[model samples]
Target: MTLVPYQGDALAHTRTWTTLHDEELRRRAVKAAGEKDTATLVSLTLAYLTQKGGSGVLTSPRTVEAYALGTRQFVEYAAANAVNLLRPGRHDAQHYINHMLAAGRKPAGVQLKVAAASCLYRALRWAGATDVDPFRDASVPKDRTPGIVKRPPYSEDDLQDVLEKANTHEKFLLFLIAHAGLRISEALALTWDDLDEQGRRLHVRSGKGRKARVVAMSTSLARAARQYRQQYGPGGPHHLGGRRATPPEHVFRYGSTFTARYHLSKAFQAAGVTFRGFHPGRKYAGTRLIQQIKDFGRVAAHLGHESVDTTRKGYAQLAADDLKGDLAGW
Candidate 1:
């Protein structure tokens, strides 16, 4: 079997691959069969999935890219040791994990890399491109760091202080994440049209796994958004920072996630609060919602999670707080 070189560019490949069928995958397998090196074979598999949308196996571009990167790392490691990535066995998987540990990669980072490789193998298997999944039984290292300190949620006073310190742009971003329980990615992805003016709901189009959901906006959030629109002209594609944007851009355009984090940290420091991260705002929202509603399912839905268990795991510490209150009553 001779693997033909992928002839598609990034944009075309992304658009075309989402609609791939099984017959096309079989044909692709023939084209990929001639590749002698495991690197090429791994690359071919990723290209096919990237183009084919991984048939729900890969979920999103970010996920596919992560897996591709992980597979590349594995392939390079295997090549140095004269091993074939495509035909790797359990021992090869273990060796890769050991190598990552030896190279000082954090347990969580190595875990993600291993998961990425596992996902690639799973995708290939689903596409009928390969039968071997070396990472099937790989033992991912656990973080043994003592006394892992979880970030505490900002108190209401702390949150308000931070908000008061932030400029309009920063305030809006913080409010959306803190009040609405939006991930930074989701808040940034919002467009003007995603807001239902009359209905008072926010349409989150790019939740994890690219799931879309409509979350009812609080009266305060709705008022803030309206005020923001009036102050900043609403001609742009995005509701936030798209006015100066070329076209079809995100709302708040930081250069990168790190830049956003830096701005957020600055805001917290200005307010004289300890800066944990924007995620603590999410934790604050989760804890409040779970406490108020006492319904994990409702909290999960509000947070755009697929399962209540996810919501529970995130806000489990709140349960301890609840128990403390109960103990006081007793």
Candidate 2:
């Protein structure tokens, strides 16, 4: 709290106390809020949020993108409803949450948007854009779904069929995720130098959380890598639609992750497998490896997880029925 000269009378005797966060920085913030320049607000917020957060050298791009989209949506909503960006009405954030809920957004989706909006407002205050955070009190519905039911992993047969039907590019890409338990982002970031086919290991230089680790490759994954290299490495290419050899440095090249997903989906279609997205393949790897090894710590490390608990929370996709046989004669 600070004192400000009262704006009431021409002959006011004293100043009045105000609760504005930063009076000195409010000038530009007030101006931007008054002008409703949400684009500037969003761009600035994204830069602030994505810059080497936590223990990582860089924030995940997926996180950066989600925050960007969520922030943009909030600002756009504010602009549409004539809500002041800096000084949103006390209930405005809740109102936006209601709007999203009514629009069929999931609770998780709503939470992300609210978090992004709140982050942007805080950043605006830091950047001297605004001193008020309208989203501070806004809340979304809590999820009630059982944790075990979420993100079930794909079956081994499903992976086998996918690889059988996929072309060389798609085949090896799935091999990285399904066999090696690599995230799609990590798989897409792979280079030829990262693979040791004969040694049956893959060096994941850019694992999630910016943690680097070498994954033990399956014999199948190693064999597939060797074949992929021999077919597509510095030679006439028959796989990539005869479009010459893929770049020597890059492993899977389809322009972007989106393009990679498209081809992978096509391969799933050809194999008659359900396209439940890519992470399930990683889940499959974790579940299968844990069942085989019976050690959460080792499997979690192999999966590049920071902890066994993290592995259990996200990748423990096995049902009770699936685990029944393990204790049959114990």
lDDT of 1 at 177: 79
List, residue by residue over 1-330, the lDDT tens digit for candidate 1. Answer: 344334555555443433468778645543443233454455554665655553444355566567677767765676687665446655988888888899988888899888766765665665676688787777876665421124456678998998889876677677787778888778867877787656888899989877898887777677777765655535633445433332344455443456678878888899999987777888777778877878888878878889877677654245546767568967
Q: Every model's Cα RMSD, please?
A: 5.3, 9.7
- Candidate 2 residues lying further than 4 Å off, grouped into runs, are 1-29, 50-57, 146-148, 235-247, 321-330
lDDT of 2 by residue, 163-240 (tens): 889887688888888879998888878887899998999899999887899999999888889888887654536435
Error of 1 at 24 (Å): 14
Shift in Å, residue 133, candidate 2 = 2.9
Question: What's model 1's overall lDDT?
Answer: 0.68
What total of clashing residue pairs does each candidate reach? 8, 1
Residue pairs whose backbone atoms clash in candidate 2: 29-129
Model 2 residue 155 CA deviation in Å: 2.6
- Who wins the TM-score comparison? 2
228 in model 1: Cα distance from truth in Å? 2.1
| Predicted structure 1, TM vs. truth | 0.72
